[model samples]
Target chain A: MGRIYLGVDGGGTGCRAAFWDTEGRRLGTGLAGPANLTTDFDAGIANVRAAIAAAARDAGLSDDDARGAVCHAGLAGVQSPQTAARAAAALPCTRARVDEDRGIVIAGALGPQGDGTVLAIGTGSFAGRRQDGAVRSVGGWGLRLGDCASGAWLGRAALSATLEAADGMRDPSPLTDALLARMGGTPQGLVAFAATAQPADLGALAPEVMRAAADGDATARGIVAEGAAWMERALAALGHAADDPLCLTGGLGPLYRAALDRDGRRFVPPLGTPLDGALILARAYAEG
Target chain B: MGRIYLGVDGGGTGCRAAFWDTEGRRLGTGLAGPANLTTDFDAGIANVRAAIAAAARDAGLSDDDARGAVCHAGLAGVQSPQTAARAAAALPCTRARVDEDRGIVIAGALGPQGDGTVLAIGTGSFAGRRQDGAVRSVGGWGLRLGDCASGAWLGRAALSATLEAADGMRDPSPLTDALLARMGGTPQGLVAFAATAQPADLGALAPEVMRAAADGDATARGIVAEGAAWMERALAALGHAADDPLCLTGGLGPLYRAALDRDGRRFVPPLGTPLDGALILARAYAEG
Candidate 1:
C-alpha cells in the first residue's frame, strides 16, 4: 500500500480533507457536509471520515492504503480539553490528532518554526501564537461576547449603522441603501432574516462595507477602519507569545491586507491550507 | 365605563402588562409568553395582547373602556422607524405609542427634564439619554454588534476568561468552576452544551459572575469592572445626557451598584418598571 497523510479542516460551513505524500505532493482532495464539532459532533466526525474516504477513493487508493495514513483534524467547538481527546478519538484513522481549527491554520502559516502569529477571520476572528510547544490564542469569544472586527461583527455593525442613518441620527450611506434593499427595505425584515444569520452571513456584507467606503461613505469606511483596528489589537495580544512573522488567512484577510501590512508587521499568506497543517502534525507523530 | 390605561414591556422572556386608572392608581397586572419582536413578531404582539387582556379582565374593565384608554408599549427588536410604526399599529389600543423598550426605560428614569441616562442590561445592554423630545442611544447593539456590559456580554466574557485560565494564560476564578459545572464537567460536554446554547441561556450565568465578584474573585471582579467601565463609556457617549441622574436597571444593576456609584455619578433606580413608564406615557396622552 502507498503511504499517504491526511489533513482535515472542519468548519461550520463544510468539511475539507486533503491527502498528500510524505514528500509534500498532493494526492487527493475531498469536501463534505458542515462539521463544526460544537453543533454536530457525531455528524462532523462522520462527514470528516466520509471526506477522507472519498479523497482516498478519488486518488485510486485502497482502504488499506488509506488506513495506513495518519490524519490530523482541525476543528471548532473543542474549547474544552476533554473534547480535544474525544474529537481525536472520533476521527476514523489508525493515527489522528486534533486541536482548535485556528491552531492548525497557525501551524500551517508559520511552517517548521511555528513561532509567530496568525489571524483567521472567516466566520469569527482569532489570533493564535505558537511558542515552545505550547500555543496561546485570543479573540474568539464567540458572536455574543467579542467577535469584534470579525465577519459577524462587521455585518451587524453595518446593519446598525444603516439603521442609524435611516433614523436620521446619521447621514445616509450607500451601505445603508444596499443593506436595506438586501433586507427587503424594512428593519423588521432584517430582524427576521437575522434569525438564522451566522457569522459568515454578517461577514459576507463586509465587502459591501468596503465598497461603500470606496465610494466615500464615511460611516462605512469608519467601520472598516475599526475592523482593521481590532485586527491590530488581536495581533498585539499575540505579542505576549513572541514577535515574529504574522500570517493572515481567511476571506477578510486579503481585504484588510494593506491595513495589516502597516506598522512594519509582516503579514504572510499561509504556505498550506489548515488541513495540510493537520497532515503535517499527523505525519510528525507517525514518524516519531 | 371606567377609563383604564395599559402599559406593556414586551421582551424575550415574556410580556408584562400593567393597568392603571387616570388617577395614577395601579389596577391590575398580568404576564404572558416571550414577545421579543426580533425572535417572533406575531407572538410578541400576541403576548402583549394576552397580557393586556388579562390585566383588563382582572381590572373589571369592559372592552369599550379598555379601547377608550390609551396604551403604551416598550418593545425589543423594533429598530427601524417603519417597523416601530408597524408595531405600534398592531397593539390593541385606540391610542398607542411604541418605542424601543430601552428608550422608555430611559424616559422613565429622566422624565420631562430629560437630563439623565439609563442602562438596560439583560440579554443585551444599551444606554439612552432623554434630551428635549429626542433620545440618543449608545451600545445595545445586540449580541452581534455591541451589547457590552449586558448579561449576554458577561456570560460570554466569563467563558473567554475561563478558557484563558484553562490555557494558563490567566488566573483561575470562580467563573471557571461555575462554567465547567454548567457545561457538565467535561470539555466535550461543555462544547455540546454551548452548541445549542442561546444568548439568553448563557445570560443565566451572569448572576454567578456577580456573586463571584462580590466574593472577591479577581477574575470575576475584573469582568464586572470591565462591564462598569463599558457602561461609563456608554454614559460618556451620551455626553450632555449624563449631566443629570444616571439610572441603572435590569438584573445586574443592584449587584454592580456600589462599583458604579463609586464614580460619584448620580445614580437613580428606574422610577417604576418599564411598564410603569408605558403607563405614565399612556396617562399623559390620556390627559392631553
Candidate 2:
C-alpha cells in the first residue's frame, strides 16, 4: 500500500514540515509561524498542523492521504508533558511521534543507522549523539538561559558590539554602521529596535559580525571570538561526543565553521535543509 | 531654617527614599515597589514619590515643608528624556534633580566633591569614574546587553554551572543543590524562575558558586574565576579615566571584593547607604 509521511522541525521562529514517501524521497516542504511552546502553546500546535497541510498541498496530496500518513516532529519546548500534549492534540494521523529538536537534527546528520553526533544551530543550539545506539544530548538550553554559539548568541553579540561602539569603549565597527543604518542612526533608535528583537533577528547579523571581523573591527572580532569561545565551551561540554562525526547546521553553522578552531571529525550535511531530516524520519516510520 | 532634603535610590527591584538634614542626620526612610525603567517606568516614578512622601511624613514634615525641600533621585530608567521628565514632575520640590543611578551611586560613594570612582553592583552592575570633574563610565551596558561581572552575570553563571552538573560535564556543584532547591527540581522550573529573577537575587547565592569552587566543581570555579576576570576587564576599561580612589558598592561588591585581588587605592566608601550621595548632592546644590 502507498503511504504518505510528514516530518517537522518545530522551533521558536516557526514550524517547518516536509512530506515524503517510503523510499526517503522528499515530495514537498512548508514553513509556518513559530511553534515553541514557551511563547504560545496553542498557536504552536496550530502552526504545526498548518505547516503539514501546506506541505501536503505542495506535494499535490489530499487531506485524506495526509491523514493516513505517519508523522514525526522534532520540536523545541518539549521539555514538558504539556507541550507534548499540545502537539499531539494538533497533528492527527495514523501515528504521530514527538521528540526534542535535537533528535531530529541528529537523525538528519547521522541518518537512521548512522552513529555520529550533530550540533543544530538556529534560534537555539544543542549537540546530539548516538553512542552505541543510545542517543544522548547536551547544550541547547533555549535563548534566555543558554543555547551558546547559536544564532541568538550571534545576534546578541552583534548588539553588544554595536552598543560598545556607541559607548566609545570599542573602535568603530562595520557592523555598527550597518546596525545603526538598520536602527535609524541613533542609540535611542537602536534601543527601540532591540526592545522587541529576537535571536533570529540578531542572528541575521552573524554574517555582518564575520564581515566586520574580516575588515578589522577589533570589537566585532572580539565578539565573534567570544562567540567562538562559547561554541568551544558547548563543544567541550559534549566531551567524547566531539570525536563523533560532527555536523553543523543553521544560519551560524557555516559562518562560524571557519572560526571554530577545534580537532574534531567534521562534515556539513549536503542537503542545506533541515526538511530533509524530517523526510527521512517520516520515511522510516512509513517503512516500519 | 534647617533645610530638609529628600534622597531617592530607584533600582530594579524597588525604590528607596530617605529624608535628611544638612548635618548628615537621617530623619526618615521609606521603601516602595519596583522602579526599573525597561520594565516599569510609571510604577518606578510612583514608587519614588510614594517612598519620598512616606519619608517626609515619618520625618514629621508638613506638606508645605516637604514641597519646599530639595529632592535628588538616582534612578534606574533616567536614561530617557521622557522618564527623566516624568520623575522631575513627580517630586514635590522646587529643586528636583534626576540622574543615572550610577551617577548618584558614585556621588554617594565619594560625597559631593569627593571625586573618585565607584563600582555599583546591585541587581545590575557598572563602574563609574569622575576625573577633573567629568564623569566617565565602564560596563553597565544594562542587563540584557552587558553588565558583565554584575550580580546578574553571577546568577547566570550559577545557572550555567547547574546545567553543566546535570549533564555531568562538570563535577557536581553545591550550586547544583542550591539551584535545584531554588528551581523546584527541574530545568523547566528553572527557566520559569529565571524569567522573573533578578541579579541580586542570584548574587545572593554567589557564595554557592564560591563554595562549589572550593568543593571542586570545575564549572563553579570557572564561574568565579571568570567573574574576577570580568571585573578586571571593567577596571582596565575604567583605567582610561586616569583617576584615583575607586569605590565599590551595590549588593555583590563586598562579596566579590576579596576575590578581585585589587589594590587599596580602590577605596570602599565609608557610607553604607547610597542615599548619602543624594544628600551630598543636595547639600552641594544647597551650598552653591
Poorest 10 consecutive residues of model 1 chain A by lDDT? A234-243
lDDT of 2 by residue, B1-288 (tens): 478888888887788888887677888888888777667767777888888888887888888888787888888766677777677887888888887677677777766664676777766777777776777776675657777777677778788667766765566656677787778787667677776776666667666666676677766777777876766666666663333676768766766666664444455554556777777767766666
Clashing pairs in 2: A155-A202, B108-B277
Residue A122 accuracy (lDDT) in model 2: 69
Worst 10 residues of 1 chain B by lDDT: B186-195
* Candidate 2 residue A276 C-alpha distance from true site, Å: 2.3
Docking class of 1: incorrect
Which regions of candidate 1 are displaced past 4 Å?
A21-24, A75-104, A112-117, A127-150, A153-195, A207-245, A253-269, B75-117, B131-141, B168-194, B208-243, B254-269
Write candidate 2's Cα lDDT for A4-25 as tens digits.
6788998877889987777667
What lDDT, from 0 to 1, does candidate 1 have? 0.74
Say which candidate scores most in lDDT.
1
Write down the TM-score of every candidate. Answer: 0.77, 0.87
Positional deviation of residue B263's Cα in model 1 after best superposition, in angstroms: 8.6
